[model samples]
Target: MSKSKFTTIGRKILMALSGFFLMFFLLQHLTINMLSVVSPDMFNDVSQFMGTNPVVQFALQPVLIFAVFFHFIMGIVLELQNRRARSIKYAYSKPGTNSSWISRNMIITGLVVLAFLGLHFYDFWVHEMTVKYGGGDMSGLINPNDLDSGYRYHEELVAKFVDPVRVIIYVISFVLLSLHLMHGFQSSFQSMGVSKGKNFIKKFGNVFAIAVPALFVFIAIYHHLQH
Candidate 1:
């Protein structure tokens, strides 16, 4: 292949690798967050452990943050390059109809997800990390860092979903996530040149695409119903 084609191929490989890494991170995050539904104390213990563990705080957390940042930057770079290659114009514009809407608008959904991430950090991370250090009330939870403050972070999360507007937003964002994953999971494999053309691989992807977001939806609904 020519140098340009080789470079394009390499960039795609990087994007796919970064994307899959982020997907794994998402699953880990969701698993931890889902603990809040089972037991507040368990979630608090785990969260506090994650927050206070020396190895995790100094090592894994930084790595996780780097993964998120790298994935985001690569995604933007790839999308921009793709748009430029297409001359920023769609011929028929039926890509959304032909494939999942999330695939067609991954960038848009990613931005929405990014916004929610900010809100999420504000709700939990900022308070947990800062309030204990006398940074003051970021989300007005009152002594958010003191595990003994009876803060009940899980309860706080459920309360947030009590607002109809926020619930709607959460559900909508999750729907976008579902769409995004439907395209993402298989596309990542394709990018890696792992096209086996096997029924099992396709079925696994389909099941994963459906199950993951369904779990998120269930979590959202469960929280919404709690209040």
Candidate 2:
């Protein structure tokens, strides 16, 4: 095969791997968020561990960021190639017939997902890092029922969702994520040549795509209503 063909295949493989890794991260993140709604103390303890864990901070976090960046860059490249192919007069462009709307509009949905991710990092990650590095005054951020806690994980979460605008944006973003995952889940499997038991993969993707995002939306609303 030509170098260009090799590059295309390599890109697709990287995209699929990065996407799968992110999906795992989302599952872990959602589980922790759900815990916050049920048990605030437990949530705080878990958050503290996650924030302070040297391996997670120095290893997994960096790898996760790279996966996100690689997935996004490859997605843009693939989408551009697809667009150029469709622009050719002789190329067939029966998108809906060949694939679902979510699959066709992955670029749009992915962009929305990325936007919310940036907002999320700004809201929480930046603040956490600032406090950790002793640059910001996180003096009064206290958790529920704790006077000595350095950061208020639960309080910060509820405060953000109490804003109706942020809640609406979060809900919309989760919906877009659901749509994106509906196509991406099974598509990733296909790209990686996981053809055995295709029906199971499709069913799992459909259920997971709906359930995970719905759960996340519920978590957001739950926190919003708490305040």
Candidate 3:
């Protein structure tokens, strides 16, 4: 194959791989966060383990950070390419209106998600991992229930959720995320050239796109209600 063709294929492959990696990461993250809804104690236990465990702290944390960074960079590159390709301006165009709004505003949604991620890391990660485990700070700003006796990270999470403004932001962010995932889940497969059918795949993709995002929304709402 020609060099240009090879480059295009390689870029697409990287996008697809990074997308899949991030998707799996989201599922894992959701599972861990959802533990708070089930049992605060269990959630705190897991958070303590994740925060303090040498393997996870030293190995998995770096990998997770790299995955997020790669995903964001590739997304920006692909989006710029897409915008450049669509040179013609649309006049009252409603193409793909049947698709979810998230499908249409992925970059915007991604930015929202990224913003929330920063807030999340500061709220939980920095306090639990960096301060507690890394000996950075013990200012009692995070978990206030006696760190020496035992870490109570889960209580901090619940306290954060109780704030009306924070709850609203969390809900809004997750709603956008749901919309983003509605497109992202299936688009990842299509980007990888794994699907060929125009009819069956399209229908299946629509279902998956809606379902995954809805699941996330439900989880978020459930937590909000519990708080």
Candidate 4:
């Protein structure tokens, strides 16, 4: 059964599931990235493992890619369906009277996040793939001839954030991501019918949404400052 064919409620539930998974992924990614700031060697070691390991590169990577696309596509379908359900237009627009801007423009924020992902993949994953396969080097070294040259992962990361314009784009994208997650996180719980402790859920969602993106922004700025 295709996700496109799932009942509206079923689709919402699955969408929420994927959202949760992505959230978990984001935390793990941030944790690994944080190591770059704490210890370059540790970060490089982890990156090498992730880049080389079959389970992560083959099994989890594909699933992660699928989930990203699935969540984005499902959001579009859900938004269109919601619009269709409100076929009769409300002539006068009192924007905030009904829904917050964050709620109303989830798709817009998501598009920005999606665009950032493209830039991110080109910066890291694509480069990693090229190095690991195209260049025939999985040593994570600058020069294969010298062992004391150290790993290339940390340097590559630093180089990417050296551009001021890129850092601005990254920060802006993360701000929008926070807005998207602010609504999506709580809504995911709502869609899944976990109505128990609704207030607590909303509070936790707010914190997660804000804190995660804030950390990402800090990382980007922190790296940029280092160079």
Candidate 5:
């Protein structure tokens, strides 16, 4: 049966499952990215492995792509349904009194994140694929570490942040991402029928929401200043 035909709770469960998977990817990707700040050699070693590993390349990447697509489409569907169900706003509605801005504006923040994802793919993924498969020059770009790592991925990464405009946009994106997580992190756990109504669980989720995206913003700023 189509997931869209499922009950609201069921669709939320699907969204939660996809969200958790994406969070796993976020952790792995963030760990690798932060290495560029601490140890470029380590970053290069890990990057090469991830780039060359047949399992990661063939299996996990496709799964991640599907997860992203599924989660995004489901989110939009839910948003539309929510709007339809509440077509008439309360006459004296005080939105802030009921819900926080981040919670209320999830769809807006998600759209910003989606737009950033497109720019991000264009800046890195598309370029990487072009150089890898289309015989474009990857070696011409100057390496930040002054060492020939035989791959220009690290150099390309640093290059992207050197632009002030890109850095600002990246910072803004991460901020919105953090706001999205502020609501999503805990909500996912609640949907999965775990950690619901638990104070400690809620606290953990709140901390994760702020910390993860802050780390990403720091990475972008660090690279921009380093260059």
Candidate 6:
């Protein structure tokens, strides 16, 4: 009934909305990344299109970046609020052992994922932006001088992943990401008040959380093995 309670609820809903959007984005991203293994040419084509498309570059890209930041920032805010409220209300309460470890450590996993995002942006996004927008060449060719050499996207991906240390780091980060999603996916639904078929949703979330991050791990290892 308190205003702070209402605000917390509102923030949860907003966070849930942003989280849902981000989950969708992650799936889409994984699909695109998977193309590198299935067909490098196809991956390059899609990457080239995504890179050069004005609609994506000038419109959706900014929105995606905003959603990424907004989701994590709101998550941190809600976690702090929860800690404050718990201090006041559960001062003498015993810690619930029934809770899953992932649920208790969402903030930790979330922060790790946040750091991974920075590495990802630096590794791919920033470099690609420099090449596409700042390098004075719109052609996606590996060598702009020779058009027959093929696109640079797939080459860049494989080469960047060739370093074993980086691949290991990526795998570890994705494993933690899976744990984060396991708790987050169901919680997002609950936050949105979708209680019908809750059990089924939870099962699907478990599958999805594992499958997506596992595939990402596979992708990193697969590319690293190419060397």
Top-TM-score structure, candidate number: 4
**How big is the positional error of residue 29 in model 6, measured in Å on the Cα after superposition?**
0.7
| 10-72 per-residue lDDT for model 2 (tens digits) | 778778888899999999999999988899888877887888788988999999989988889
lDDT of 6 at 114: 94
RMSD for each model, in Å, please? Answer: 4.0, 3.0, 3.9, 2.2, 3.4, 2.3
Which candidate number has the best lDDT? Answer: 4
> Which runs in model 5 stand beyond 4 Å of their true positions?
1-5, 136-149, 195-197
Query: What would the per-residue lDDT of candidate 6 be over residues 129-186, giving only the tens digit for each residue?
Result: 8887889788989889998988998998999898998998898899999999999999
Tens-digit lDDT track of model 4 for 1-227: 65566788899999999999999999999999999999989999998899889999899999999999999998888889899898899888899998899988999999999999999999988988898899989788888779988889999999999999999999999999999999999999999999999899889989999999999999899999997
Task: Point out the higher-scoring one by lDDT: 4 or 6.
Answer: 4
TM-score of model 2 (CA atoms): 0.90
**Candidate 1, residue 82: how far the Cα is off, in Å:** 1.7
Q: In model 5, how large is the Cα lDDT of residue 65?
A: 85
Q: After superposition, how far is residue 55 of candidate 4 from its true place, in Å?
A: 0.9
How high a TM-score does candidate 6 get?
Answer: 0.93
Deviation from truth (RMSD, Å), model 3: 3.9
Local accuracy of candidate 5 as per-residue lDDT tens digits, 106-183? 899989999999999899777767765576443333452455535565776898999999999999999898888888
User: Model 5: which residue pairs collide?
Assistant: none
Ten consecutive residues with minimal summed lDDT in candidate 6?
86-95
Candidate 1 lDDT, tens digit per residue, 32-85?
Answer: 778878876777667666666779778987887787777677778878887888
Candidate-wise lDDT, in order: 0.72, 0.86, 0.72, 0.93, 0.84, 0.91
Determine the C-alpha RMSD for candidate 5 after optimal superposition of all C-alphas: 3.4
Q: 3 or 4: which has the higher TM-score?
A: 4
Comparing candidate 1 with candidate 5, which one achieves the higher TM-score?
5
